[model samples]
Target: MLEEDLLYILALQRVKGIGDINAKKLISHCGSAKNVLKEKRHVLQKINGIGAFTLQHLFDKGNLKEAEIELTYIQKNDIETFYFEDKNYPDKLKHCIDAPILIFKEGNFNLAKQPIISIVGTRKITSYGRDFCEKLISELKPYNPIIVSGFAYGVDICAHKAALKNELQTIAVLAHGFEEMYPKSHKKYVAEINKNGGFITDFWHNDALQRENFLKRNRIVAGISEATIIIESAEKGGSLVTADIANSYSRDVFAVPGRSTDNFSKGCNDLIKRNKAAILTSAKDLVEMLNWDLETKKERAIQKQLFVDLDETEQQVYDFLLKDGKELLDIISLSCKLPVYKTITILFNLEMKGVVKPLPGKMFEAI
Candidate 1:
């Protein structure tokens, strides 16, 4: 159905000013898109805003060769094309007026499932940017939330890297087409990301990454995600634009509080002052604001972490003594590579934790 629907979308997007609203109007007047394509010029003129200027623009792009070229590139790059009507297209982003007629993407990412939090900020970030990124991510990890960011420098890259380092999947909404990488530096990491994450964009291969185009892409990033976080931003920074758009979409917006003296933090402060975003001091606050309960589920996680605190030598000795009980001296000399006296003291702590059983002749076994 997407492929069939794309036939009309590709035709409509090629028009300069004719966007989703106008396209829908035209389709409504003339049945399906397929029918509209075959309809007479006067029928198209009957649609609202389809006067002579709009009609001329429509006819010009309807038969443009660019769509064919874009389709060829889509096949070459293995991009998945999504139409607004398709189930695969994200429901949250569908009602947007500027929602792309077609979205091109790759990888195993599902845009619809999993709650998403979009982290955005300026290219020039601060130490607070890096700190909040790591801290917020660690706190949110238990929820297994999918993180979304623009994949730009500073806060965006920090969020993506932190997610990847934690072995969590993420999504990056790009301002450019899928034909090539925009920043070029991110190319090194994109391949590995494909295994667990993906990049999404509506730009056809022919649609280049232009400065103004980013304004359009910002809405997608804001609309698709459930919430948005601003880490560090100048007063006029682009991250505020994302927050504004998120607010317009009725998505919750959060910002990290920063010192007023810092120039890069001005945007976040301004957002809070304007009531555009709530100030978040910790990721736990974010979790609470979202009404997500991760406290109870993390008890097992804490237990697992505690179990991994044993040193490599202690782990080896513990495993070796598991099957058959062995003397402490033997475990020390053979498994621990430490003095028998030191190993004895270490095993005493394990006893306190009830992780090991002390048997006859100083023998021990995992509990």
Candidate 2:
């Protein structure tokens, strides 16, 4: 979490030719960015991939100073940084071979809290694909899915809109910095997304938007999500690259099948044909997949067995909370089927076993 460590790593990643693998080797052997910056060519020579040209750039005076300047920038911006070793880092992404050592993010995204599923596909998405995205996410609203996707045009944008519509927290894995978004048209959604979710990138504030970054971007989009859903994709594009990377990370991938003759869905159909992706028919499939991993969900099912069916009073209280996540007193006689006096009695018992959280207003939500 220290600014120095984050700055050094971020600066090193910005090197012209260095990639994740090269940067990893440098960090692993040298121990710190400060050490790597100070090392001579001979010291770096011991590493397999460190060439003379690479070493020249590594030890260059300009790069070293730029690293310090970037660190200062981090302090000034209050930019939050996450390292691979950090507890709050995404567990799913940490396992990937090319995972970045540092991720620069803005807003309040809690990567540790839930299962993430990325939905991605063609930039020129069909009406059917957009409809599927909306319906699937709506069905998943009850599970509180934290949807992840590139906030690009077409399918990426559709998934994000659906996530927001369903009132779920979603993360947009950006290809550039929080200071800028590649597609200028998405600037407005980026603002809305900031309030509801977050944007993540490894590149720094001044990082330029280039076509090459999109390739690098795909890895992160796929890495952070538990499962990647390809809604509509052409034979070769960023979405397909992301799906391939998701497979490399040993993550499950699902594809929404589209018309066979449609060029836009060619990549997804090919993946399903090769068994590279599971054919996803609905959001229930994703909900069930994610539900299996929820620790509280299994316990809830068992606890539900205990009650089997709620009594008249219990049913009233339970029914009210099911409609919305609320606090105390609001659950009084209105929302529930029971009256205030009886509801309070049942609320106490439900609160005792950790089934619900009692807020100041006395509203309740499933725990």
Candidate 3:
């Protein structure tokens, strides 16, 4: 976006009572943020949802003044900004109705066409949760997914570190602005994270860290990814809020089941019981649900092998596909007398072995 346009957007953000949704409405009604600010008060009020209170502060001169200062900070620090309507904005997040109209970023990673999943849980992570989180990322390394987290203690930090260890890009979504690091201790990871991926926030450069900001930022964590995983959470925690947001956005959510007696597992178990999330036991569960192993037609030639070996279950799935030519995933599972999850896992294995290939609409065929 042009600097002039960014200036108006930032100024619009400074206006009180006009949140993301209302701001978006105003921006859409008018041609741009510049026009919205310059538009007459009566004419603006004529648009739906634009009331006296919202437009009361829309013409504040200080809004532009503060925006100019922040714009200079952005230019000087080389901060990247993503406008909601811009093609470069995160594709998944753009679909969300409550998504930020503008988000500030400072990162070295590219989100284009990459598999992104947010891993969020309690700050008081247990040994069990830590192991599952690390192993999950390690197993998913082959798929080259972008790991996203809040950059706090426990599971969030663990996910970021695991991604870094596996040489994968990791994004840290902050609850504060670029100038403020909430946990001063996390400063050590900033340089490394910026090198591997980077930090993103909707807060301004000078905004102070606040408790409510954590909940507010959860939307971005949920919206930016194709899925959100909860490794561990107490009966109540921020991770649960993220799960709710993900569900609201209609994105896939997975929770690692844990012992009923464990405090940290209660939230995840409840999510599963409430039908808000799928049971996530291992990396295969996620890969199968997300169809990450499905190779496109162009890539099928290279993926197929002249000779390959398959286990009994894999062979059954492959043979069925061969005989049927094409079949729905559920039909194959019913014919093989296996559960849907197990059927998906077996089919993925066959795909990897170059014997079976996935087609559109959950259909599969033999090579």
Q: Which of the predicted structures, 1 or 3, would earn the higher lDDT when compared with the native?
A: 3
lDDT of 3 by residue, 14-83 (tens): 8888999899889988989999999889999998877898788899899999999999999999999999
Give RMSD to native, each candidate.
20.2, 14.2, 10.9
Query: Clashing pairs in model 1?
Result: none
Indicate the residue-level lDDT of 182 in model 2: 67
| Residue 103 lDDT (model 3) | 92
What TM value does model 2 have?
0.76
Residue pairs in candidate 2 whose N, alpha carbon or C atoms collide under 3 angstroms: 327-362, 327-363, 328-361, 328-362, 328-363, 329-361, 329-362
The better candidate by TM-score, 1 or 2, is 2
Error of 1 at 50 (Å): 4.0
Q: How do all the candidates rank in terms of lDDT, highest first?
A: 3, 2, 1
lDDT tens string, model 1, 1-367?
6555566667777777777767766775776776766688887887777876776777665445666676667767778877766688875576455677678787767655466788989888788789888888988887787888888888888898888888778888888877667678988878877788988887777567799877888998897776899999998978999999987665679988788999988989989998999998988788876656545434534563477577776666655444223334543453445677777877877677666777666556556
TM-score of each: 0.76, 0.76, 0.81
Question: Least lDDT summed over 10 consecutive residues: which range in candidate 3?
Answer: 297-306
* lDDT of each candidate versus the true structure: 0.75, 0.76, 0.89
lDDT per residue for candidate 2 within 22-62, as digits (tens), equals 88778778888667876777878889888877765665556
Which portions of model 3 show Cα errors greater than 4 Å?
296-367
Is 2 or 3 the stronger prediction by lDDT?
A: 3
Supply every candidate's count of residue pairs whose N, Cα or C atoms clash at under 3 angstroms.
0, 7, 0
